[model samples]
Target: MSSDPWETLRAATRARVGLGRAGDGLTTAENLRLAAAHAQARDAVHAPLDVDAVVGALGERAGPVVVSQVADRTEYLQRPDLGRRLASDHGLEAGTWDLALVVADGLSATAVHEHAAAMVDVLLPRLEGWAVAPVVVARQARVALGDEIAEALGARMVLVLIGERPGMSAPDSLGAYLTFDARPGRVDSERNCVSNIRPPDGLTYDAAAEVLVSLMTEAFRLQLTGVRLKDTGAALPSAAG
Candidate 1:
């Protein structure tokens, strides 16, 4: 078993809030104080976001789903090639699935923590024809990593819900990038991204769920996604690109 990034992250949050430490159960006043301090400390980082913690937090649901732990970002950074896929030993899903939701700790863990599961929560129920498997990653992952995930799970489409680098205003925002027939050597524009996924900024989780369903439906009907498929209401995915 791997470490719980959310637990680790929550401890950081509590420490910032003066909650003492993990499992300490701080009082309301302590929480408020910590929140203030956390905010200040976060602001000090010019918008701090912890990608591992965030992605881990988002996958907090109880189910057949399995979440990965914080990977080594050091190797990912020093060897960009290493970040493109999970290890063969990682043992992601082995069988076929209609869709594999690959969660990554991109540049902002907080965003993954806040929005990944919530977004998937709203999306999965609406996808009638889709068989979903959860593949979570740690370290500063990237978009292309989904190709390996698709290959591992034998999935036709790969949707990666990862954290965007935190900005000054939106620190805990998540994003989804969907690619059809996702495998190796696919171009970047070959995918479609539904970004700005936090509340009050972009589409709500429920609404975005519908949009994703619609997009996938169209992709299924037309046998395409990414730049080759046409959205239900919009121009070709190329235009959206």
Candidate 2:
């Protein structure tokens, strides 16, 4: 029998559970790992998003990309309201799409840089025939920012792929939010979120895409999201399977 019960469980998930103690506190190794994760979380929050790289990775498949109203990382963190508006008229063609896809650097630029393009690759194809607006690449953005972007594009729905707040175990997790009838003043309950989207440790791109597609389909038909929309969709098969 293993002395640490968590050792066996740890292999099953990335969650930090059943960590054994050293003396009266965490083991030195555990403490060090925690500190490193904390540092990563902080770095992710302050990291600068490279909009051009994001655009390039996206392969210009959908449409033009644009920034949000948030001027800089500092101001973005300080003024949440600013991130929710459009920086300018550069927002793409309005009133032409059923969905507005937003890729944003929400707390973790690393998460966006790592997963945004891949997730889009999986998601966009699944949403074929649905009018998709330009893929908006926003910097220092919040979840609500997608609402205004969708509103600007006159999209019926806004699918925002942003970085989830960093945690000790998952510092670079990406999250997706889908809202029906997206616009400013919409509350949190009006949106549905698919979170923990980093591969190997969290939901893979394919799985997240599957979940997202299912939700979007339902949201459009029922015209609602958030608590009202249940995520009973099946996850995609593992790459190994």
Q: Give me the candidate number with maximum TM-score.
A: 2
Q: Quick one: best lDDT, which candidate?
A: 2
Instruction: For candidate 1, write residues 1-241 as lDDT tens digits.
Output: 4364456566543223223544657777766765775574354223333544544555553222222232564554466566675554665656778887776766666666667777877777787666776555544467778887787778888888877755544666678888888898887778877777887664578766766777877777877777776555552222342
- TM-score of each model, paired residue for residue: 0.66, 0.90
CA lDDT of each prediction against the hidden true structure = 0.65, 0.85
RMSD of each candidate? 12.9, 2.6
Q: Pull out the clashing pairs in model 2.
A: none
Off by over 4 Å in 2: 1-5, 89-91, 235-241
Give me the runs in candidate 1 sitting further than 4 Å from their true place. Answer: 1-71, 74-79, 135-139, 232-241
